[model samples]
Target: MTENGAQLFARLETRPCLKDIEPQLFPEGGGPNHGEVVELYGTEGTGKTEMLYHLLCRCVLPVATGGLEVDVVFVDTDYSLDMLRLVSILESRLNAGSSSSAESDEAALRLCLSRLLVVHCSSSSQLLLTLHFLETSLSSRPGLALLLIDSISAFYWLDRCEGGASAIRQEEKLRKCAELLGRLLSDYRITVFTTCHAIKKVYNGPSSGSGYDRPYLCRPWQRLVTHRLLCSRQETNSVAPSAGGSEEQSRRQVFTVHCTSSGSRTKAYRSSSFCVTDGGVKFI
Candidate 1:
């Protein structure tokens, strides 16, 4: 049975796109759409995971609180997910909204947390299995709109060592993972967000060689990425006037996120700066 054009357009209207997650990061207002993959790559401590948390929060919160109110499946391969940190940020976001009683806030927090499904994977094989499991889970839950995998390159060196001199064997597991991900995207209307660590040193001058910062992942995984975000961090000094008429010097870390899209249409490259505070990521 083929659907008519009117029915197809109606179905498209109901699909969710994350263009409003962070306008500052995606100034063009074209965020990750359904069945699309977005990759974030950077060195450690550059706030890649923190950005994931922010995006996850946006998906899980209710519509009344300015969130998408959709379910999220978060696959944690690096074992770096801090539930306490996520809860703290969620609490702050909830509190910043309309004032309510403590009981109501707690209930809202629980409701938001309920929308998230967290799975931990210790190895590449486990990660692959997890994706298979997610297919069944997504089928039962129509509200699941986002899938997050923190640091998909967590097992890069391990696979390399195990493969020895065979390049084909080295990328075998991830290649399969990429294939499975593509199938999942085709079967479901969900968006994927994964992180890749920067393996090579970053150079800033024009003399830098070509392919210096190219992604080290296999072609299968790289080909699935529709948006690539390069993250970097820098430290800056801030001086404030104290009540006692003395100057106070403090240092703060700032993260710069630049995004490039590789789709049918051209999009202007955009970048934004932000700082990670106790509350969450505050864009500047």
Candidate 2:
């Protein structure tokens, strides 16, 4: 079903793939299949957080502006949320326009604020339990619209996996986590936005730090995400020195969305220069 209880993209229904539908640059409804398991992956700080915050603002927007007048459920496992930043994005929308529409937007904003809920977690087990509780909570109150799990990979113990024999155990652990997440997706039709760490490995044989390439997501988990995206950062100071672009060109972040399994998938790509301001990510 389409996000608003509409019959679309389901069995026996004809619908185009997300990539085929050109993504609206700054709008929330621009993307495809909202109430599905969609994953956003990147190394670190490549606008995943920013995009998520922007989405939060959009949910508060009135229906006139292509936004669903609904609520947001943010599950912050990494404690990466910034409250002031949230208010900034909400206020920016109100300030963007004036007249009767602005008044309506403000009203919608207030209502959404009342409905919004956040759950913070320090451990993977807590995160899982909280989500289970959320499922029960939402059934009682159906207005809890979208559910976002920021940085799912952060829950795992990153440094614990060294090499050789230990790698097998790590994979098994990862596989189990993926299984749990998959079950949740099937049970709930909420839009699941998860931020993942894209692993990268280098061959240290003869070429030191050379032949570096992008790595895929973990297997079973990868299959669960119907729509997957990669957020690549611009050539910032932390990035490689020869990371492309000119002297005057400011760094740009990439948002590339694709599908899971085989077949042709839509590649809705976006590359824009942005920075983290007091108001979160601002497109430059």
User: What Cα-based lDDT does every candidate model obtain?
Assistant: 0.87, 0.59
- Show where candidate 1 strays beyond 4 Å: 1-15, 201-212
lDDT of 2 by residue, 73-128 (tens): 88887798987788777766665554557676667567757767888987666776
Off by over 4 Å in 2: 1-22, 25-35, 99-108, 158-177, 203-217, 235-284
Per-residue lDDT tens digits for candidate 1, residues 168-222, read 9999999999999998887676899998888775667777654325788899998
TM-score per candidate: 0.92, 0.66
lDDT of 2 at 270: 51
